[model samples]
Target: MSAVPESNWSAGRPDTGLTPEERAAEQHLELLDRVIGLEQQVAELQSTGLLGPSETIAVERNLAAMRSSMTWRAGRLVTLPIRAAKVVKRRILG
Candidate 1:
């Protein structure tokens, strides 16, 4: 008979190693942090009335491009199933 080796739970701890979902979540947080920092800087600049017309147009263009991105479309599609599941659960419980 062959013996199976036991998993080293401590070695595979979440803090030591990340699963795919955990890695993705970490990346999302990092991106969000960067976005927040940029937003804060923009706000500070605007408060000082230093943000020019060119900068405003550039920000708008970047935002429009992001809104039309494949990642944004995919994210919308990915949430559809979750939204459907929530509707089903609510209908069933009610």
Candidate 2:
């Protein structure tokens, strides 16, 4: 029988020999999963019909203002399509 080689285990890494591309893909999937979960939570919050407390409302208004700004809009316009494509690919694969 042929001898099987072993990788070094001195460090604290726990990976099971995933290649770089495979590891990157795994991390990407994890990020996509987090986005999906957060979207679900936001949907649930919206469905509650509670506008939240006054401070929360104020914070949300400030957030909306920030989102509406030209800089933010421009950044979103550039980055969101890439993120959307990744999300779409993940959905299609699943």
Candidate 3:
């Protein structure tokens, strides 16, 4: 049998072998950081109040467009898994 490479092993690293809970905690912290950053941006925008009514409306419209685009992309991502499952199911059931 070939010897295992040292670089390929994690014999003693606790942090390297994270449990599901630890992985979830790390993801939660990352998401929290993003939320905090968005909050800061909203606060800054509120404080400035620089844009005129028409400009604000235009900004709102642009934001809506961006949100729609993001939703479309997210839907596509979710649909990919569904499509793959359908193909697999068809192959299995036929």
Q: For each candidate, what is the lDDT? A: 0.77, 0.77, 0.77
Model 3 lDDT per residue over 36-80, tens place: 888988998899869889999999999889867978779878899
Q: Which parts of model 3 have CA positions greater than 4 angstroms off?
A: 1-15, 52-94
lDDT by residue for model 1 (1-94), tens = 2232334333566677767787677667766877888898889877895557999999999999998999998998999999999999999998
TM per model?
0.37, 0.40, 0.39
RMSD of model 2 against the true structure:
16.0
Q: Which pairs of residues have clashing backbones in candidate 3?
A: none
Off by over 4 Å in 1: 1-15, 51-94
Task: Tell how far residue 24 is off in model 2, in angstroms.
Answer: 40
Estimate the Cα RMSD of every predicted model relative to the unseen true structure. Answer: 17.5, 16.0, 16.4
Q: Which candidate would rank higher by lDDT, 1 or 2?
A: 1
Residue 83 of candidate 1: its Cα lDDT? 91
CA shift of 5, model 1, Å: 36
